[model samples]
Every structure is written in structure tokens, then in C-alpha cells.
Target: MIIVIDGLNKHLFGDVLDEVFKLRARVFEGRLGWEVNVVNGRERDQFDDLDPAHVVSIDDEGEVVSCMRLLQTTGPHMLADVFSSILDGEPPLRSTQIWEATRFCVDTSRLGQGRAKNSISYVTSEVMIGSFEYAQKAGVLDAVAVIDPVMNRVLKRSGNAPCDYLGTAKPMGKVTAMAALMDCSDERIASIREFAGIQHDVFLSEADALRLMAQRQEAKSPMPKPSVANQDHKPLSTLERYFVEQMRDARTESEVQDVLRLIESLSDTFTPEQKDALLNTPRAFAQEA
Candidate 1:
């Protein structure tokens, strides 16, 4: 399943990003021989400290297999700081709606090679789907990535090719890099889902995600007490649970408004107890990311 680790929920994921950084060390520093700093066997850079969103794909075993980092283009990003040569002296694109995707890598040794589960092809598409879907929901318009020719071809084959190239490819230390732009649109996201044969939501629900993290921890301890323990504290009906999951994934205020409107429309269909559960979801999600 895919888990999005942003500043809001990073504390809940329990070192999933740390494992992702180790994979990057193996792929970029060990295999690809990039000049990235590998401290304590984890490949990390300055951008990681900026609270960029980490879209992570984990195997059924709850180990991070494929992942990517996303940073708002309005601030410092890879294209502006590290891979500026790809822009050929032009100013990097800076906008609130644009995010730079970097440090994309997969655990080839663990996943092996094939289009089936636990393979590079499968996880690559899964992570792409998560990143695009998450960004689209967050009101992002576009994403930029600095990729090599091999990865460029992979994107083309996976039905997620870049719509535009910012500038000519330039030689990096070990590989040539080109800045490619992709739209965060439904068409783009649908094409990748079709290629990957994914017919359901890629993300795990909040409860399921926390369970996965708990499974991976050595202590296997329960999560911290929720901040809303003083709320209604009533058990949820199936219908109410569905709305809670929907609201959990809703990012923007406008999206939350749409969900609230839908719940209001079904007032006559739900029982009083069920309706109360649904309406009280705001307290459960009072600390929404």
C-alpha cells in the first residue's frame, strides 16, 4: 500500500522514510555511483530537511520498496539548487502549484524484476499513481523531475511520460539529467492506473496505515491516544466509517466542503445515531493535515 508522509503525519509512520533513505543510498550512491552524501548508510540531502512530502510505497511486508520526495517549487528545490544545469542557465520555475519530485528509487534486489507484485515495474507505477493522485487532491497543478534517459524511457513505457522538457539534457557527475514537467490531471493519473492494472484507491486508510507501521516496529506498541478522546466516543456504523475515510483523504478546504455537502444530502437515508456519527467527524479530524 502507499503511505503519504508529510509534516502532519510523519510522526505516525515510524521510520518508513528512514528505510526509504537507505534504499536511496543503495541505488544512487552504491549502484548508480552518484555523489550524494551517504551518512550512516542513508542517502540524504538538504531538501529532505525542508519537510517535503514523501510518497512511499511499501510491500505487503510493510517495508518501503519505492518512494519519491516532493517539494513546493515556490521554495528551494532540486532543480534550483542541485540540478540547475538541467535548466541551461534559465531561472527555475517557481510557483505555488508546482512541486519538484526527486530521490525516486526502488529496491530492486528485494522486488526483483517483472511486472508482477514485488517487482520494479509494479512498485514504480504504484508510487507514480500515489504521487499524482495526492498532488491533484492537494491543488497542485504540475510536477517537475530531473531524470536520466533510462528513467525517461521508463516513464514513457509506463504511460506517464513528461508533457514537456524544460531544457536540453546536461551531463551530471555520473549521468545526464533533463528536467521534465508533468501535469497533475485526471488523464495523467488514469493512464498510469490503467498501465498498472490498479482498479482501487492506492492509499491505505488512516487506521490501516497506522497498523502497518505498528507491525514494522520492534515493540509492536499501540499508537498514542487520539487527541479527540473527549468527543462523541460512539462506535461508527459502516456508513459513518466510509465518510470518515473520505474526510481523512480530503486535503483542501473545498474538498472537505464537497464531502460535507454529500453527507448533508444523505440526511434522510441515515439513522439519527448514524447521522450523529457522520456529523461529528470534524472532531475526529480536527487536526487534519
Candidate 2:
């Protein structure tokens, strides 16, 4: 399933965004050899600080399989600020109806081949469908994507090829990059869905999303088991240990705030009765001698 994370709800999905960035670091920096900023295993750029909308495809286990970053063309975007060489002196396209899509990637190492929902082909199409649907609903008529030749071929194979090209391809680290434009319309989305054999809604419920995210975190770094000889040592529960680790790993004030917000959202995962029961549970108490 896919999850749309934008400025409005970003505060609620910090962990999701973190996972997206980590995946980007692996693909862009580690795999593609791009000269991108990677801090603590997260590939982030100035555009990320601009609060761009992220359309991410998540697996049943809550792992981010594919993702694309969307930014309005009316503001500072890649073609305008970073990849000006591609434009070759022509003015950058700026309009409210046009948006810029960048950082498109998929977890090729994890997703296998075939037309199944969890396969790379299916997840790629699902991400594209989510992006187009999201852009169209947000009043965007066109999307300009900064992608490589390989990605261009993938787009063409998926039946969502770009309607036009913006500029010549230029060397970008290990691969050449170019700009291509695609119309964000129902026809394009339908074509991708048809190609991928996706016949139902792709969005996951909020509760399911949260649970998946928690599971993803656990899968990424499981807690170590306590040793038998350490019976005298106090051990934290899994939840408490995870919370402490998150705080310890935080590098900035914003990250600390994100950790707090994620903790706050955990309250919504349970009902009032469950919350009451958890709070009213009996615990051992020491009596004064």
C-alpha cells in the first residue's frame, strides 16, 4: 500500500519519513554513487527541508519499497536551483499547475521480479499511480521528473512515459540525468494500474500503517536478548528500550521533537478501554519496614 506524507501530516509520520530518507541513502549514495548528503544513514537535501510532498509505497511489513518526492514548480526546485545545466539557459518552468518530482527510487535489493503485488514491477507502478493520483487531486496538471535513462526506460515500459522532454541529459555523478514531463491525468493513472494489475485502493488505513511502521523498525534493528548471567542487572522492556534508543540516536533538536511526536501517536493505536486497562494494571509495591 501507499502513504501520502505532506506538510500537513508530516508531524504525524516522522518515522515513515525517516525510513524513506534511509532508503534514499542506500539507493542514491550507496548504490548509485551520488554525491548527496547522507547523515546518519539518511539521504537528505535542501529540498527536503522545503516540506515537499512524499508519495511512498509500503509493503505489508511496513517497509518503504518505493518513493517519490513532489515539489511545486513555482518555488525552488531541482531544475531551477540544482540542475540548471539541463535547462541550458532557458528559463525554468514555474507554474502552480506544474510540479517537480525527484528522488524516485525502489528497493531493488528487497523486491523480487514478477507481477505480484510485492514485486518490483508492481510496486513501481503503484508508486507512479499514487503520485499521479495525488498530483491530480492537488490541482497539478503536469509533473516534471528528474530521472536517469534507466528510469526513463522503466517509465516507458510501465506505459506512463513522459509526454515531453525539457532539456539535454547531463552527467550527474555515476549516471546521466535529464528532465521529462508527464501529464497528471486519470488516463495516465489508469494505464499504470492496468499494467500492474492493481484493481483496488492502494492506501492503507492509519491503524495498519502505524502497526506496519512499528514492525519495520523492529525488523530493522531487533533488541538483543538479556544474558542468563545478568540476572542482577535491570533490563528495560522492548518498548522502553526502543524509545530510549530513538532518543539516543537523535542528532538534532528537530529529530528529538519527531521522536516525541511519534511516541504521542502511539496513544491513538489503542482504545479507551485498552488504555484504562493498561493504566490500571496491578504492580508490585514495596512496603516500608
Candidate 3:
């Protein structure tokens, strides 16, 4: 199941939490230099101890895969303290009803090996949708991402608000995009979940569900004039196989929906219920999402 844990409570700050930090350092500092907080192999900063963050997604055996930090609009955030230079003296962030989304990262190593019922991308989408729910419940209005312009466009095209260029979009570094939550409506939240197609706790709209179905159909349809050699023998990747494997073990409709989401991300196709019945069978790894 997609778990949502708020705050660095006592439980989260335990040994598993240490593992999460080490993993973060391994990926962000050791590999990407995306962070400078590592001092002798520990990954942490002031933000680590503060800010009510959300940890979402788990591995095949149930481990954290993806997470995001959110700060209430009432306080100072990275936008004000760290990224102030990027923002031209003043950002729209000061406006009421906006919480900053930061430290958004994924444990790439543990994802897509049938680790969770959903893939990494699927999990992240779920987190975003979950973030919206969190914001709605908390009465927050906007969710900001320190992301690239390209990612900003993707979010906008997928129905997010117009992004403010808080930072430059670099090939190997950070950028910023703030996504506003336009609708706190129950209908809107539900639509987000259904459209994303991931097994999330939030409610979803049927229209969003239908749109996802259409998008999947479009993704699966054959394109014109593709290379013949590339077309004929294109087998499913290891990740694709893993997704199908997860689908086989799904026990509930929500679980099935989660697996279908992973399939949609990979194959870009949504099969009918009749077809799905053929897909859902017992599998070797029966772990939760």
C-alpha cells in the first residue's frame, strides 16, 4: 500500500530512517552532488530535523522509495532561505496559501524490480496527488516543486497551473516550479487520483479516470514511419515485466488499479476488465505497494 507518514516522528527517526538518509546521500551526494549536506557519510541538513514531510511508496518487501518535504505557508522555506537569489528579490511564494515542496527524491535502486505495486514514476505521481490531498486537508493552496522548465511544462500540460520560473532549468542541476492547487473540491481531488490511476487513498473523479483510459489507449497505438527494426522485436523491458508481475499478485480493485497504473506508465495502454482479468493472477512476489 502507498503509505503516508507525516513528520519525522520518533518512529521515522529510527534505524530505517537512517537507512533512508544514507540512501539519499548515496544518490544525491555521492552520485549526483545534488546535495552538500553529507558530512562523513550522513545525509542531513536543518531541513531534515524540521518541516513536516511526507514519506510515500515502499519496495517489494516494504521499504521507502520516494518522499517529499512540505513546509506550511506560514513559515520560511527554501525559497526564502536557500533559493532567494533564484527568485528575483521577491517570489509569489510570500502570498498566502502556498506550501513549498522540496527535497523530492526517489530511491531509484529499489523501484521497478516489482518492488512496489507501482513503478517509480507511478509512485511519484501518487505522491504528487497525495500532496494535493494533504494540502487540501491542511488548507494550503499551492504546492511548489524545485524542478526544471521541462518538468514544469509536463505538470502544466497535465493540468497544473502556469509555472513561475523560480530558477534555471539545467541539464544536471536544480530548477523550480510552483504548482497551485486550484480546486479543493472533493471532485477535483478524486479526478487527480483517477487520472493518475495510481492506488492512492484520496478520492478521484470519473472524468479523470476516463481521460487516463484515453491517454493509455493513445500511448499504446502504433505510430507512423518508425524504424522497422526497432518496431518488430521490441520486447518488454525488465521494468515492464516487473509491472506485469505485480499486477498478477494484486488482490483488490485498488491494488489492481495501482498495477494498471504502472502498466499505463510503461506500456501506455489500458486493457478492458475482461483483459485485466487475464492479467491478474498469483505471482512469485506478493508484496504490498
Per TM-score, the best of the predicted structures is 2
Ranking by lDDT: 1, 2, 3
Q: Write the per-residue lDDT of candidate 3 for residues 195-228, one digit (tens) a residue.
A: 5565536432323333333334335544222122
TM-score of each: 0.75, 0.78, 0.56
Per model, how many backbone clashes are there? 0, 0, 6
TM-score attained by model 3: 0.56
Compose the digit string of candidate 2's lDDT tens values, residues 168-208.
Answer: 99997788989999999888898898899897988876556
lDDT value, candidate 2, whole model = 0.79
Residue 50 lDDT (model 2): 91
Residue 153 lDDT, candidate 1, scale 0-100? 100
Ranking by TM-score: 2, 1, 3
TM-score of 1: 0.75
**True lDDT of residue 208, candidate 1:** 66
The residue pairs in collision within model 2 are none
Error of 1 at 20 (Å): 1.4
Candidate 3, 57: how far from true, in Å?
A: 1.8
Instruction: Evaluate residue 253 in candidate 1 and report its C-alpha lDDT on the 0 to 100 scale.
Output: 76
Pick by lDDT: 1 or 3, better one: 1
lDDT of 1: 0.80
Better of 1 and 2 by TM-score: 2
